[model samples]
Target: MSSQRRSYESGHKPKCLVVVDDTAEWDRAVYYASRWAVRVGGGVVMLRVIEIPDQNQQWLGVADVMRAEAIDIAEQALDRASGRANGVAGITPERVIREGDTIAQIRKAIEADVDITTLVLAASDGPDGPGPIVTAMVRHLGSFPVPVVVVASSLTDDDIDALT
Candidate 1:
């Protein structure tokens, strides 16, 4: 609920919140976040978001099953991402799974964790245009709660290593 960040507090370390959406370039975000954590002595928190469409209440049972399935997929994706972060920087990232609107969930996560000081995202470099999240985020540029770092997907691991 607080707008103020606690990352600089006496006992807290800054953390980067990386969304582990199943994008082709998500690895770039993870790589940057993990490396930054190590270089700055902070931490990495990987988040997987599952979006469910509004449906009839009559399908409550179906919704439960769908939610369960989504959670499983989210876990698998986070596992692979977590492993990649560990492999890249020898650090295991904190994993978070949330369901609902992507931006809303991301905001909630940041609000709940005061130490999360930055959001690391990867931009789509293909002809399809910058990724969905990136497009949606344009609306919140200045009003966003935390600073966002959008890494270009075209950047190779070596390129990111040099930058981070």
Candidate 2:
């Protein structure tokens, strides 16, 4: 096993799983996760879930193209989040891409990787309120094996600096 994974599995460190999205709101989660990893001698897993639409597949080629587009978007989100996380000291972030229900994929990721000790999320504070995924996670908190930490959408640079 890799040193980081070993440390994580041995309880020497606690890995943080940060759900990343293609929005500036996710910066808070990334910042906090990176800081926590730096403090705990662990690493961060930046996960991007491509939520496939629940629509009837009438055309196979169109469905394939849509799936490809989703993958590309997910990859871009992961790459951007990775860059942000990498800026923090002592943090080496890994990216994980998944397709399906957001909550289900998150659960699968945690189950697949025993190293994850905590889940981090960035919630929207706008008029729409916290998005559906965040709401769902909140409602199903008891089902999660790892502790969940949510970052408010309104946090400013000073707030982030203080958090780090």
Candidate 3:
């Protein structure tokens, strides 16, 4: 076994990888991830990747502006996630932003960095109706180095109100 895995098994803080898409469901996802991280005595790393537009598109000017806006939106979402996690009694989450295909960037970051032990993702609403973000994660799952957890969108307003 790798030294890192050994260390994790010995109770070292496991790195929790969270992929944040700027969506309304993000708050619930953050809350779920924070709860799990606290349970495992792990720290969270939240990532938001800015997906570049395809070259076939003619609106390069608009694409550039959109890209910048997307990055800003992602950063704000991640910041909110981190703040919510920090509000939890035993959880602290570190946030990161990257530019590329979301799954590819996430995989590269996890492989290049040695700390991450488990990946956490929010499940798509359903099959066939799966969105681009969900498709990306599923496509790249085979290449991931650690276990992946898909948090159910089970937390309701009652849960959030309770947390507050």
Candidate 4:
């Protein structure tokens, strides 16, 4: 048997990976994903993406204040998500903080983490439409590496409960 086929068959674990942010949309996504994870006997992985700003000038050994601030914001967001996840039963989800473009980071994580079998995200209805990250995934990926579950901003508590 080919190594590729072997890896493909074994790599997928009964786990769900969810992107978490400070927005209400993300909170809804996390709630639904956590419940689903509990019901399916799978674990959840929370990923927080910090988009680093483009620095125009070289900082000759100087500290990058913007990067530091971004990290702080990211940490706070992760803490909020962690607190919410505490109520979830079954498995305690692991949190990951990454620095880069959201889409790129997500793609890298999906490729590197073989345990992830599903990707859960949230989309908000704005003047432009759905959240950019969700839209990007749907547009560029064409066929995502794993099945994606998108929780909308308008989802009610009952809607989230129905996920389980």
Candidate 5:
């Protein structure tokens, strides 16, 4: 086990599960998770789920192509997330890429793999903003095993200046 994982096992600190989607919104969750991890001497798991299209006998080739694309996208997203987290101090995070239903996969990772003491999620901007994805995540949160933290996006510079 890694030193970070060992720390979690020893109950020396908390473990955070961060669900990473291919969107700028995830930055909010990552930032919050990193901040909390440092404050509590905890570790983070950045999980990216690449949904595989349903396989059909006649569409094996198409499915293969889609799977490859999904893998590529997930890898890129994970790499960027890792880099961003690394740039921050005292926020070492582990990266994981898996296939299946995003919510189900994330839940399973938290339950069976990650020793998650908290679940940090980026809040969806709503129906006029991001649609079904936000709904699905909200629905799943009700049954999540660990405590869930939702981080809303920060205001833009223009918006902040306007308030003043």
Candidate 6:
């Protein structure tokens, strides 16, 4: 929590933060966020975080290469997500790429931007259950910086439109 939100006050507008982690159900979240932005006259923020693995001394030189690769992938993911959001609501979303724990990065993004009032995520339909982030989010839902909206993987565009 970072001070009182200034959303809908003059220059500031409410925003929905959507994670674009290249997950199988990422589109669901983006769609929901885009629709929400259009309906409520809010904005959208898309975030992609890179979770880099630790490397040994022998792999010192490879760290740079790995980081470069991760950044490139992050850019591509954000591009696709941005395209989808634009197609849905004709709104260009603010894209952010951070390197670290997903949940921590999300918190940083929200703290960095006061207008972001909601987090939208899509559940994975795997037999194991919803994806890790969504599962983890369930446990911390009560203390998360903002309200979260979880979209089911099975939802169609029409289903989302009707709900939003």
The top-ranked prediction according to lDDT is 1
2 or 4, greater by TM-score: 2
lDDT of each: 0.93, 0.79, 0.69, 0.74, 0.71, 0.92
Writing each residue's lDDT as its tens digit, candidate 1 over 49-164 gives 99877769999888889889999999999999999999999999999999899999999999989999999999999999889999899898788999999999999999999999
Q: What is the lDDT of candidate 1?
A: 0.93
TM-score of 4: 0.82
Candidate 5 C-alpha lDDT tens digits along 1-164: 11123336654556788888966678767777776677677778999988886888899999999989988888888888877777753455888888998888877777665467877777657545643445577776666677777666564434423332
- The sequence of per-residue lDDT tens digits that candidate 2 reaches over residues 25-94 is 7888888888878866778888888876656667767778888999998888888788888876545688
Error of 2 at 18 (Å): 1.0
TM-score quality measure for candidate 3: 0.72
Q: What digit string (tens of lDDT, one per residue) describes model 4 on residues 55-150? A: 657862233786788778877887777677667554578888888988778777777677677788888976767777787887755656777888
Q: What is candidate 6's lDDT per residue for 19-121, written digit by digit as tens?
A: 9976799999999999999999999999999988889989977987999999999999999999999999999999999989899898999889989999999
Residue 47 alpha-carbon offset, candidate 3, angstroms? 0.2
For candidate 6, the per-residue lDDT at 56 reads: 93
Return the candidate ranking by lDDT, descending.
Answer: 1, 6, 2, 4, 5, 3
User: TM-scores, in order shown?
Assistant: 0.97, 0.84, 0.72, 0.82, 0.79, 0.94
Stretches > 4 Å off in candidate 5: 1-13, 124-133, 155-164
Q: Residue 46 CA error for candidate 3 (Å)?
A: 0.3
Which pairs of residues have clashing backbones in candidate 6?
A: none
What are the clash counts of all predictions, listed in order? 0, 0, 0, 0, 0, 0
Candidate 1, residue 136: lDDT: 91
Clashes of 6: 0
TM-score of 6: 0.94
TM-score (C-alpha, index-matched) for candidate 2: 0.84
Q: Which regions of candidate 6 are displaced past 4 Å?
A: 56-58
